[model samples]
Target chain A: MATARAADEAPAPAAPAFDVKNAFRNICGFCHEDYGRKQGKGPQLMDNPNSDDYLFNRIRNGKPGRMAAFGGAFTDDQIREIVVFIRKLKPNENP
Target chain B: MKRHSRKAITTASVAVLAGLAFGAQANEGILKRSANDWPSYHGDYKSWHYSDLNQINAGNVGKLTEAWSHVASRATRGLQGFPLAVDGVLYYSSPYNQVYALDGATGQMLWTYKQKLNEDLVAKQTHSPYNRGIAVGFGNVYMGTLDGKLVAIDAKTGKLNWETKLVNSEKLTVGFTGAPLLVKDKIIIGSQGGEWPWRGPIFGVDAKSGKEAWKFFVVGGNEGTASDRRDTWGGDSWKTGGGGGWMPGSYDADTDTVWWGTGNPAPLYDWAGDEWMTKGPRPGINLYTSSVILLNPDTGELKGYHQVLPHDAWDYDPASGELMLIEQGGKKYVVHPTKAGFVFVFDRTGKPVNVYKGVDNINFVQDIKPDGTLVGRRDMKEGKHGNLCPAIAGGYSWNSGAYSPKTGLLYKVGFEWCMDLEVVKTTPILEPMAQLNIGANFTFQPPKDGPARGHIRARDPVSGKVKWEMKFKVPPHGGLMATGGNLLFIPEADGWFSAVDAATGKVLWRHNNGQGHNGGTITYMAKGKQYVATVTGFGSLVGDAYGELWGEPWVSMPKDAGVLKVFALK
Candidate 1:
């Protein structure tokens, strides 16, 4: 098997521009469902009554037994972007 | 034609008989398990998931009552592990790597062992904490931890024998959630992959002393090795091709081969359409993933394989189903169900013998031929596609089906649902920590045939001839078990555990365990008394959708609770 590259051997590349839309599709949409417009595995996010701080913290430090923490995987700014995306979610006209 | 020649023939026959008996014993209680023990993950090497204990038969199944129950602590996503019984002791695992040894008849806790884990790493994982099952042999109980270690606990006394760190889960963010199969002297376990951007590796570890033996990369096979099929992927796409044998497979003692299934490739949905061979994110056939792999357990060598879905863009993994070893008309066939809702039958050599549909709504491909070719392929470009059949949750989930030799039938549960998908082009997340590489957003919807529902069907393993079926409002997330008592035990998602006639599909007995079932059901004999034990809880990755889809008990069900409920005749 190919060995995992050592951190020192390969310099870290620049972080790409965060695409919350595509990011939701790739990760959060699995449980959020319908781009957060509808409830599925998790509650619907489009009209969620929770505050933005609550959403950001929930995304960063996930609730135990319910969701996984993304603090390590995503930057704080990216998590805030996710909160904004959740706030902007609306029902798809086509759907 | 002399009297002396005839005497030599009789002596040779005796020697052959003795050889057969020794071979059975040499397998070390796996091939020929005792009536009281459920030693291996699939109950035996055949993956029968059936017990021969008939002390509680269909006639007296109505008198079955709960003997005792043991509640597991910190059952985050519930107790998903199957219990193993040997010599009146029941060994089971719950979430957070907690193992308990109980008296099979009394449910009295003898001892418990809790492994110290990297809690921070586990908290960051998507499929965290829940242990599926364990293996028991060589005076030890083997379990795979969520933090990427395989530990052996002494079976008689709950003490750590040894622990081996196999995967670099801190970097890759994926580890072992499935049980290890005790093949001879090696503990073979597969890592969780598919959606993660990593070459999922299945390891063969020394069972006696927790030492790393061999590893087989299911993604692009071992790097630079000929016949590893690394050429199946384009460029460096194989580096994160995402293939794993996340579930435990069975052993075929006749051929001395392990028949395991592999998960699908990363970036589950392809956006290249028909130009997949050259233009896709990870082009070529992506060999070995979504396939039935025949392996040499001792060396982790790929013996032969049949890719069930070539270029599987639907996340239809063959790894979810148990490879049921069935013999029909003198031909031994491995019957496997892919997540795409079709069943493939193969010979001992990994050659496809037959293909049949297990569920009704399957439009991912128009048809999968008996030769394992996908016809009328539905390759989606980067756009919205309507009503893709057999939704993201799959026509079949990771739970296993049961096959019974008594009734000559295979009992399986299948879901009927479709999805509205919008395929997106996403970049692989491989730096610092790996994340899910799903390339599509989808929502569950009812199939054209009817509402979204599930059914348990008893069918011929080779022919797919349905004998009978019982439909449910919601699918059962747990595994099924059949018995020689002519009863099929099904733990439903609505907290009901029922015993139905294996031949008739009639519910003979039912009991509510207060939560949805999402783990395993098993039967074993303890002190000459037959007992049925099942793990009950809720909140699996797929099962988490139950609240919105069917909103009654599930909306109010507890997710962090689990119990091992054992029953016997009153």
Candidate 2:
């Protein structure tokens, strides 16, 4: 009975971690092209991933106050990319 | 006092400033409106966002590179400031009310005055984290703090001359957003946060002593309307009313009358709750929420006014723009551009003369009737969710629109792209960024559409016509300005600051500044050399969406993250 149960159980791989660079390139729309500034809309997410949740909440919300909201505007997966991108720019990792 | 000579009132970031012609003494503000010295917001209150030096005009502006960039450090200070230059010194109020004086030619820090802040300093700044900036008057520069204090410092030495607690928000608290307005020995300033049961008033403070000279409250705005508010607000419209004068006002020294526009009634969306100030004799007009209200600059007495948005339900604030008075055809007409999309022209008598819709993609006001009665749009309904045009941020938000006296046109960059908006009723009490209150603000969803997706248009003041417009990759990132030459500088939501032919509306040149812009553009002559400057700190409501929508319109320049970039052609 144990051998039969083991045969019935198939394995599933875990979800991958959000890639900071890929997320950034995805948003920046420029892969391997580091345009330090000049990227409009929202400035570079560089090192901002470590910001407190509320600031990120406000930033991701689209509208800060009386502006507009983006709760449903972006996918959660994409947002995870934003979080990862901010993390990748850790000074220790880069230098 | 000829028209062209008055053009020398130089400044950066136009703030609905105004002026009047005086004797030909060349005594405008302290200096000739140089192309480098941003003497006052809107130059010198003549509200001419125009500069005198044509050094960086259409011809050679191509060589206009970022001459100097003061990128802010996250821990040191944020760049939520408008740099005010007097002669060769540049003064700016940075994050935490830290004042920095920089050299005009080079963005070199000369002196720094950091206002010590405790942990509680973060609490007072719920509205805007940073001060709009400081004001330069006489020989001193003035600034207000987040912890509730206004300090005056020697403009040259950066030494504290006097520090006064104007309104201790610690009790009955409110924030300061209206940049200080200095008129002679007095400075006129008002506070924001009118929505929060906070008492709103515009005061005349002694410029030197920091003593309060006069205070004007909006609850009882019109002295002539009798003491019994019940008579003025026939229905229960006067109670819990929230008309506040939040921005710096304009003045006519000759007439001794200072004019300011007040904001919308409180519990913003609930007209019924705040009916005491809304319903009755002053009912629709509401005794000046959206009007050009005049008072004796010294007395603070109600002189005269004309309502622009009677019961501004659409959240279309006429109070956002400064009462910029423009003179043409020997007639003194005040051109007060409203966030609601109308550039309402009124004679000095406070009578509406003509109203023009500066933007076409607006659904805020129904129509500016022949009699100046805003019928309001017919399809505009309450308690529903749908796409609203021109957004509550407005067709032309708080960004200052400059007028080129040389061309007789109001050079403006209007935020035309709209949002799908839904209004709901709410209580007066609102938490900072909560999920509870939905009344005062409408739900907006920015649309996918034409080049007019948040655009910038040039208009004729007298005719109320769109001369030519440059659609932004997204909404206009900032405000606009015109110079002595045929040049109009406008910013795009995607981070491109474009210079257009002020005459033909042609895109003369465009350059990227790394991020989208929301700050206004200003010009001045520094060391006899003219320079044009603007601030970019995108990522607010408009920024996040447009950046997401248009992909990318600018290249990232972290060195200038939310900085003041001054440009001059080589």
> How close is each model in CA RMSD to the real structure?
8.2, 14.6
Q: What is the lDDT of candidate 1?
A: 0.84
For model 1, how does the per-residue alpha-carbon lDDT over B1-570 read when each residue is reduced to its tens digit? 001111111233223322211122325677777777787778888898998888888899999999999999999888788998876788899998999999998998899999898888888888877999998766677898888889877665677777888888899888888998988878899989899887888889887667898888998787656547767777677888899889999889888999888989988999888777766677778877888888898898888888888878999998889998899899999999778999899989999989999999999899989878889999999989999999988998889899999999999999998989888887787666988888887888999988899999999999999999999989898999999899999999999999999999999999999899999998887778889999999988888888777888888888899999999999
lDDT of each: 0.84, 0.57
Query: Tens digits of per-residue lDDT for model 2 on A1-95?
Result: 00011112222222154343322322232211132122223344444434656534643564322222323323556555555555455432421
- TM-scores of all predicted structures: 0.93, 0.75
Runs off by more than 4 Å, candidate 1: A1-15, A93-95, B1-27
Measure candidate 2: CA RMSD.
14.6
Quality class of the docking in candidate 2, CAPRI style: incorrect
Best by DockQ: 1
Model 1: pairs clashing at backbone N, Cα or C within 3 Å: B81-B132
